[model samples]
Target: MNKKRGQQSVVFSIPPILKATAAIAGPMEGEGLLAGYYDQVMEDDLAGYDNWEKCESYMMEQAVTTAVKKSGHFMMDIDFLLAGDLLNQLIATNFAMRSLGRPYLGLYGACSTMAESLMIGAMLLDGGFGNKVVATVSSHHNTAERQYRYPTELGVQRPLVAQWTVTAAGAVVMENGTDGPKVTAATIGKIIDAGIKDPNTMGPAMAPAAVDTIWQHIQDIGREPAYYDMIYTGDLGKVGKELVIRLFREKGIDISRNYEDCGCMIYREDQDIHSGASGCASSAAVLCAYLYPQLAAGKLKKILFVGTGSLHSQTSYQQKESIPCIAHAIAVEV
Candidate 1:
């Protein structure tokens, strides 16, 4: 059967179920709004590791292992592992995979990695390529700062537009089953460069891309904005979240009522995170920790998860290249 949907989407012939999920957060995140939702909260960012990078790897490892254990399966039972992180060459994920000793594919979707992994994992299962798969993502605030902007020791003054990168990791087990929330459909996004260059303004830089994918998903699936109980965009902080609402409003749609950004959901107003959270873990932590439980408990029936990415590198920024962004959307139902 043809599972292809519109120009950018596909309907899963057999939606893969989300068997189990786990999230691990650093000390800062443990003090955040969704602290209670996480599977494990670390006492510090290093988690007893020698460095922040190793801590990130440890978080990913723990998240993946915990998720698989929660699924009532062992690492040997998993068919494949798809994971990523926001470090140079994905060192964090690579190191984590090394310890996990599972067949793996490393993905890089910037902050959109969690959704990208889920989309591909679902496709693998529905295509009969794999019976069970693990999708995971990780990000560390210190690591991101050192690579992307400045060293944390510099104690650089951040602008209000800037967002805090989350120190966390999240993982989920997807398999052929009817026990949990299922991946129903997905819309792959296109690159959108709105000529934004300032990395500090990532939320605005990625807002247009988020809107584009969301609009495309709605069109491809023939669903209205109200179709889903909630719509979430990954890592688009307060600024980007508002931009999406305004863009949709201009297009004669009202998404403000049911829409939220995972970035904005993580930190509290008093956390002094400036705009909010940003990083792969922003959405990953929220999805795995909070949203999954809500879905499992039937508090939320259907939802649209849009992963937003700012495709800019330190080299690109140094070269004065504009930030190109992308977003991928997944439809999940219980």
Candidate 2:
């Protein structure tokens, strides 16, 4: 049967089930709003590792292992692993996968990797390619700062528009099952550049892409804003969240009631994170720790998870090129 839904979406004939999920976060995130939902919280960002990158890899490994355990499966039973991170060439994920020893596919969707991995994993299961798959992503504040901006030692003064990169990792075990929330459908997004050149203004740079994907998902799925219990945009902090609302309002649609950004949900207002959180783990941690439980508990019947990404590198920034962004949306239902 053809599963293609619309121009950019596909309906899974056999929706893949999310068997279990895990979220591991650093100390600062442990003090955040969703701390109670996380599976594990480290005392510090390093977690006794020698470097922040190694710490990030450790978090991803821990998250994936915990999720697999929660799903009542062994590492050897996992048919495939799909993961990514913010570091160059996905080194964090590579190192983590080296320890996992499973067949793997590395993805690089910037901050949108979590949703991208989930979408692909669901496709694998529905296509009869894998019975069990683990989808995960990780990001570290120290690692992101040194690679994308200035070193943390430099103590660069961040603008109000800048967001804090989250130090966290999240993983979910997906399988063909009758239990748990199902991956119902997904919409693939296209790259959109709003001519925003400042890397620090990532929220603004990615907002247009988030808007585009959300609009397309709604259009292709024939669902209105009120259809889902919540619509979440990944890592589009306060600035981008408001931009999405404004842009939608201009089109005679109102999404403020059920719409929220995963970035805004991570840190407390008084945490002094400026615009809020930004990183691959921003949405990954939230989805695994919070939304999955909500769906499993029947508190939320359905949700649209839209992962937003800013596709800019240090090289592109140095060349003074505009920031290109994308977003992928997955519909999850209990």
Cα TM-score per model: 0.99, 0.99
List, residue by residue over 1-334, the lDDT tens digit for candidate 1. 9999899999998899999999999988999999788999999899898999999999999999999999999999999999999998999999999999989999999999999999999999999998999999999999999999887888668899999999999999999988899999999999999999999999999999999999998898899989999999999899999999999999999999999999999998999999999999999999999999999999999999999899899999999999999999999999
Error of 2 at 293 (Å): 0.6
Quote the lDDT for 227 in model 1.
96
For candidate 1, give the lDDT: 0.95
lDDT of each: 0.95, 0.96
Worst 10 residues of 2 by lDDT: 149-158
Each model's number of backbone clashes?
0, 0
Off by over 4 Å in 2: none
Report RMSD for candidate 1. 0.6
